[model samples]
Target: MNLAARVITELFQPTVTVALLLLFSPAVEPGFPGTAWFGAVAVLFVCVLPLAAVVLLVRLGKVTDHHVSDRRQRAPVLAMAAVSLLAGLCLLLAIDAPRSVIAMMLATVGGVAVLAVISLFWKISGHAGSIAFATAVAVLTLGAPWSPVLLLIPAVCWSRVVLRAHTVAQVVAGAVVGGGVTTLLWWLLLELTVRRA
Candidate 1:
């Protein structure tokens, strides 16, 4: 049970979830494969490099674990990832990547910023939050058939609690932050883009 919980926790880490989300962003845009590399660029800066930072911090003993179970250790890491996200956002804009992809990046930056602020005072479940955000985005982008993806939120929350990484309330709050923030931001960005068009 413990091993399985750990696997689930690791599987839905923010880095992985964001990578999957970015990689799927092109699909949300009209011209897919053409803008596919934009997703790759996002994954490189927002996911891969930030992940590398966490790994390096773990090696240096700056972080308690790869997951950064210690809330105190999260701010710096989140800040580093924010920088990467910003850089990705700029590059995506400069390259005029698809509106959906750019909006996704912006939404991601918003989510990260929220999590970073919350983590400063509480040990929120980044794992749960990440999964919830992904689920929300999936449902929003794919509609009714994808609504089932919401199930992953509770599963991730259960895994976090089972792993003793976070309290039930913490996990719930994480879900709220993840799903609520991203859904609002992404939807708003897309809406604004459509209006501008």
Candidate 2:
């Protein structure tokens, strides 16, 4: 594939997406919520899950003589994501921690969930859906973290498009999937946790 295609694929890939999300989150939202220990957990969930998926796919491909790209096994991928989200939530709730810590944990869970969904869509559609979903969130959320996240979204989308790993449509679709899901989760958490208190 060309450079653009490689960039696109890298951007859309779960590992890359999660890493970028994690990086951006800390960068935009300063101060380590609580113990800073939770950050390690977040990094593990973001990085390990995708790496595991890639390993599984590679092994399965070799053993079964089938082309097992991340897209082909949506169930496992989503399951991993759900597991990570649950883990993050449990950690946050169990800590008897500060509100900031809890909020940060909730945000991480929401973000990872969004990344998983986007990966699934990228496997199927391409980039267009991702971009559309992201754009909608950017417009609706305005000054929220979701909107700021849009900054990274375009770079990721463009990388995928340039690499030709995904068609413009697929890249957009992935953005939509990522942005919409994350925004919804974040909003729900805010309402349930922050507003209720």
Candidate 3:
């Protein structure tokens, strides 16, 4: 397959995107407690849910001998995107700063949208995206606590590459999608909320 196709596929992978969002939430908002619960929800919605859906689809495909194609695989990706949006909303609710929630949610969604658009047009390397995300986190962290959770994004990206599920570019695109979206959301949420007040 071409690099563009591969990058899009990797970007759409539900697991990587969702995991990145969850990992970065705490890093962005230190005052928002209950990282464990956020992590748990992310795991369930982002990882387990898509996995279960994949299993069911695989079983159905086998029973019907339906040759699974890229379109079929897109179901999980779509689910991941939906989950990421929901997770951002949940994170907004979890936060104590009412003024920031909406802006944060907007930034989160906007970032993901931008990443999706970019993935559609360009092929990104895995290391590049991972490094970008890590750097973004590091930059965002200048004022917040040094969160161990930040490491999870790279770990998830590595797993996808090691499993041969995605190339370096694809994984990196996923990282970009994950981090860019969340960061945008956090900033927007803060700004809008503050403005209204």
Candidate 2 has its poorest 10 consecutive residues by lDDT at: 62-71
The positional error of residue 190 in candidate 3, measured at the CA in angstroms, is 2.0
lDDT for position 79 in model 1: 97
lDDT (10s digit) by residue, model 2, range 1-197: 46665555555554544444343332223354434555455656656754666577667763221213346465465566667757765765576544434554565456545555656545533233334343443454355545655565666666666654456776665556555565566556546754576
**Candidate 1 per-residue lDDT over residues 54-83, each given as its tens digit:** 889899988988888988888999999999
Deviation from native of the Cα of residue 52 in model 2, angstroms: 3.2
RMSD of 1: 1.2
lDDT of 3 by residue, 1-197 (tens): 34544564356454454455455555444445544455445455545665565567678773221111233344344446557567656764675423333443455456545554554445333333433444454556464565654665666556556655557777666577656655655655555665445
Best by TM-score: 1
Q: What is the overall TM-score of model 2 with all chains considered together?
A: 0.59
Each prediction's whole-model lDDT (CA): 0.86, 0.52, 0.50
Candidate closer to the true structure by TM-score (higher is better), 1 or 2 = 1
Candidate 1 clash pair list: none
Better of 1 and 2 by lDDT: 1
Runs in model 2 deviating more than 4 A are 4-34, 59-70, 97-151, 195-197
Report the Cα lDDT for candidate 3: 0.50
